[model samples]
Target chain A: MSDVTAGALESYLTGRLAADVSVSDLHEHVEGWSRDTVSFTARWNEEGEQRERRLVVRAESDAQIEGDSAAEGNDVETEFRTMAAAEDTSVPVPETYWYEGDRSVLGGRFFVVGHLPGDAPVVWDREQRQDLYRAWDEREANEGDGKADGRAKGGSENDGGSLPSQFVDAAAGIHTLDAEDVSALADCPPDAVVERELDRWVGRYRASTVRPEPAVEECIRWFRSNPPEIPETTLVHGDFRIGNILVNEGELTGVLDWELARIGDPLYDLGYASTYYFAGKLIEPIERPELACSLLDREWFYDEYERRSGRVVDRERVRYWRAFSAFVMMTIGLAGVHRFRTGETDDVRAAWFQYIVPGLIEDMLAIVREDRL
Target chain B: MPYLEPAAVLRRFSRFALEEIRPAIDGEERFVRGQVGSMASTLRFLAGELDASERAVTTQENALHEALDGVEHTLDDHDAAATAVREALADARDTLDGTDDEAGSRIRGTRERETTLLEACDDVLARVEANLDDETARAVRRPLYDFLDARLDAQLRTLGRRNESGDGSP
Candidate 1:
């Protein structure tokens, strides 16, 4: 909603590109709520040569970070820094360009990145799931010869192995990165990761109030009482899931949405991604409820992640995080509902978030009950 | 009280917004168009839930009372249990009694009562985890879980239906 005009973008890019830039095809990506993303193609002359590039501008939203008052480490600067920190890692991140701190240029602090060509597939779409099934089937068929690239079998060069393998490899790449790399992320002692995360999220839930959520309260008490064992702490992509990453012909293009990235338990991402809620089980019962993110089998994902990352997969710890992650999702839904109720933001999507609250609570309860029983 | 009920009015407006207004918006203004679409969806959901909200709240109130009674009974049955557990039950009962306010309207009364009962549940749960054994804690949490289930059912019945597009799924 900020004043993002083509003229302003041209003026800004003219200064950055050191030439008269003509910006066109300004398209706003409205799918993500965390930031205002607009992608455009810029043409300019540099060093006596004509140049053109597809770039994206991600600006801070007017709404509070994640719509929660107590949320931290989700600012625009943090996101830019996190992406910059991951530049050398195996995780595919968009090449970060200049970060503008002045709001007069973009109406908010913003950063520009190279726009990679890919689509962030909707996980719940049946056609998309069918495509993923084919991709995985293709990989499984070529499992023996150590050359699993789909391109060898008459596919395009970018059509590497299935999205699931690339997904796990990218996650392993993130988890294997040293915590010191992303020094700007909230750092917690290895032993304190579970408690700190639990308190932080629970506090956010308690702070957000559209109505009383006794289920969350009960979960808070139970999780607090029974703490999970902390295996190893690494940079956890706090919101890791298929929908946040881009895929081109069954290969990962770029890992988008770094706002929620932080340093915490690596298993947290596995648990968060493995939640059936994201697999579309909570919305409507899908056929593959066991699939994580509607793309990969849960146990297979765990095995692959273990083999790739060389970290032991603890089912119990993953179980704890699964329940906790659902609780986290419920809390986020509550926060959105709270924002809408309080008229903090007029985004009707926030109002629609209420529909997911009950289902999320149910998911959390189901996970917790399974653990206890 | 008019010819068309409130829900009908809302649904008509929602349909107009979705089918007529949204398409009329410039496709280049994708964010605005998306907002219009979300507006239609929210209005549609609100229209559907308008009538069911009161019933859902009433069901929740009744379930809350039942859960409170069950917790009280469990506490009494476990008189030989830990002192802190007994005290937790007693404090919950006292809080419910002290916070009872029948001076408000039905909806307000339900909301306030629900809040008080939830707070009591939180207190009892916190204490129970610290004081009770595995079996005793499970027995105590069973009724609370039932209460949670009823609460979830009421909420879902009230605001659960999504459009065919599943716009906000996950």
Candidate 2:
């Protein structure tokens, strides 16, 4: 188990499926930071019939930072189970097939889910590609690319267009899920939602600082004095944004990361989604300067969200949470810079966070000022 | 108005953290077992410092509010005093233009009061400047710093103008 030996995965998958199986095209997927993700093709002969399938392996790592994964009461098992449970729901989660929580199998908790084929919606390196933009435009224009049957018939390139509508529909579906059904998730008491979020992030900010920031002190006081009231309790995808999701041909094949998924004030998710508008990748109309538009114009997505959910969003509350989210981003980004300065991770991505933190602060202040006016 | 001693408040908080919290939880489970074991202790130290800094900001905000309140209270007095000074200066100019007499004496009295009001405004401005530190004023720091700087500049210009007009005492 020092490495992902082929024998180990084959043995594990065979045990879970109760069939003799062989894994081929064994390769690792290089997208995650909290967990080691691997993908492979599986083949088996059953009753003299040939069968083949593509699968993804998700394994937890001990070295990950706390916020990169869920902080409390949730872990890899919970994520796997949540994805498995959502298979029948309108949410477009990958279909989870096997979960192995005992550490003996792969040195840590791990699971396997069906691997749907598609280009991820947010590609960090090749973000300048026009074809990708065109594909996104086409998908957003269509509700979401069609079902897998349509995908198979039309082929991978022509297959997905219904993704945007599907993603929005999936989010609405998740919001509508009964709290009783997801009782394993601890709910924030109605009154303490904002306080809990503030405390959680304040702890993160406090824990992650390597250098003294006088401005951050003022930000904390201002944030606490003006806590926004929660409009309603709903499930929050703590890291919901364009980059965290996967899409193919404008269809959302799967919701990718669940490490930070939780039950909390729904506006947190809305605010989190708004973070994408400033991600330096998702600037809309395809040609406008990313910085030209005010953050208010980005409210189109939220407006659509409100219209779809039939809930009159508290604009002030959303604005406050959005500012809170930006502050959280600054804290986390600064933390990444600290880690790099302290020799935690050698990856260059850690340093990139520093360049983004100040811009995020400026954006947060601008958002707060605009809302106040 | 000077803000209450924020630096002193911060010092007290830091002392309490070092004396009380540090020794008590030095070897707790989470503290010892986490990746950054002793780093947690360092965070506690930083938190102590942050508490002090926060107290300072609160103190500064309170002082600014108080100063603005004082300005409001003296608004009528300031206007009346300034008007009387201006009237005396005008009367002195008229006396100088015509014959020196009891009217000129009356002008001098008004001019003296005007100088006193101007002196009071200058003293208040000086205290405000002394109370403010551009770097450490965290709450409304930028605007307050600008306001104080601009006020000082404006006062200096007014003093220069009065001197040129021969209305300012030697």
Candidate 3:
């Protein structure tokens, strides 16, 4: 069944811990679509010591397993191994404990991680947007208040408790990681980055689309014919955004959702992050929509990322990936719609995705046309 | 006929769900509340769409035909790529013509017609880009781009401002 029960979890933990255990305060996070995330306190006794630890379980839901989200190379084990590898990096991922593969335990494979503090901000929420905007304002004030090094130099400590610098830091941390170190990630050759990504998303689009989207098809054609030059390949946290970053009192605590993480062009993440389709454009009241991820100034972000990663920011290549990012978003939307239409998922949000299709198509068309000149 | 219209009923129920049922549920029931809110908005949008769907369908059909006209004009008489495009278009038009007598198949027919026209447009653009010069290719793509814009405008108009929050993350 879709619902993971406390009893099932307790039984599994008891067996794994080799001691009697009780699971309580189980709370399911309501936001995400792909995984079923449950946070709870598990009490057990080991070596005559009663212990209590708060933990989070990330499991593949039926929708994730059977729906279009079953994209190749993305699975619970991959996510588990990816996080385990990143534990040695600067990225603030949740500390992973163990991976469970036996389906009889929780109906599917899941992994446990230490429950980290912080709420994942919903970027579309007006209050969250205001919070990020205030962070930007505070950082500006600090920068002007004789903290030039803070803004100019760029570091987590000097970022004035705002998320922009930390956001860049997290992205840089991921991009700079040795791809070979992450043994679970698929090998994406430097030469085939653009070709592979285009083929993957375009193939998914063709398979899952409910109708013929000429705009999307045009984008696919354009992208296929005009593949961007890959500068270098690195580990890309494919869904890098403010929404995926956990924030507590204006500080980024953990980067959540690594299912989309992979080995690809690092610039792809930058392009995905900078899409207005995913940022300030969602908030009707935000007057400044140029902030990358609705947090960092676009140019500032590029400059900061370049400075941190020691990689030159190729604005032209970024532009190509930005346009391709629209296609990625459109393909994902179509996938959700396809899953819904095919009766694979009953989630109303999946059906609701059709609402965003036109806007994405408009973005793709506008970008290619304006940028072509 | 009933005194209350179906759209009006849907809107009223949507309001009831958002304002009445949602508030009555405990605040801790965030998932349930979110679902209720989504259902309300979806029903409200559906109510509006019920009235506008026919018009939207007609507009889309017109746009498809216009795009197909531009596609046919751009194709060459003897080129293999152009032949492929013509074959796709002819097959779609034939299917549409065959289904013209069935009133129930109107929407499906329009959608199938749209699929064929759009695929042909893509094929033509690909062939033109490969065969023709940059300047000529741009000239050929201009009208098709216009049709795409019009079709998208009709879609946006139909969808309105609902879910303006943009795309969701996985």
Taking the tens digit of each residue's C-alpha lDDT, what string does model 1 give over A1-373? 5567789999999898778999999888999877789999999987888899999999877764334442633888889988999887878999999898888897878899999989987766788877766666666666665666444446433234667878887888888765788887877878898788877888788778666666777777779867887857888888898888998766789998988888888999999998877776544445666778878878988998898788988988888888888888877877877877887877887777777777777777876775443
For candidate 3, write residues A1-373 as lDDT tens digits. 2557889989888888999999999898988877888999999998999999999998888866555466833899999999888888888999999998887778778999999899877667768777777777776777678553355336454343357778888888898775798989888788898888888888888888787676776777778778777867888888888888899877799998888888988988898888876674521224456777778877888998899788988987887888888778878878888888988877777787777677777767777876332
Instruction: Identify the candidate with maximal DockQ.
Output: 1
Q: In model 3 chain A, where is the ten-residue run with the lowest total lDDT?
A: A280-289
What TM-score would you report for chain A in candidate 1? 0.92
Better model by lDDT, 2 or 3?
Answer: 3
TM-score of chain A of 3: 0.93
Q: Per-residue lDDT for A1-373 in model 2, tens only?
A: 1135578888887886678989888666544556777778888777788889998888876544223433422577877766665565657778888887677777777888888767554433344234444543564444354442234335332233244444455566567654454654676666888788788888877777754433344456557768877657876666666556676655566777776666777777666655533344221212321211111123544665576677777877766777787787777677766667777765445554554443454445445433221
State the weakest 10-residue window (summed lDDT) of model 1 chain A: A64-73
Please tell me which predicted candidate would have the highest TM-score against the true structure: 1
TM-score of each: 0.87, 0.61, 0.86
> Across residues B145-169, which tens digit of lDDT does each residue of candidate 3 receive?
8777777766766666443432322
Q: Each prediction's DockQ?
A: 0.35, 0.02, 0.30
Error of 1 at A344 (Å): 2.2
- After superposition, candidate 3 runs with Cα above 4 Å error: A1-3, A45-50, A64-69, A148-161, A280-286, A371-373, B1-4, B57-127, B162-170
Model 3: clashing residue pairs? none
Identify the runs in model 2 with alpha carbons over 4 angstroms from their true place: A62-74, A123-163, A276-278, A281-297, A370-373, B1-170
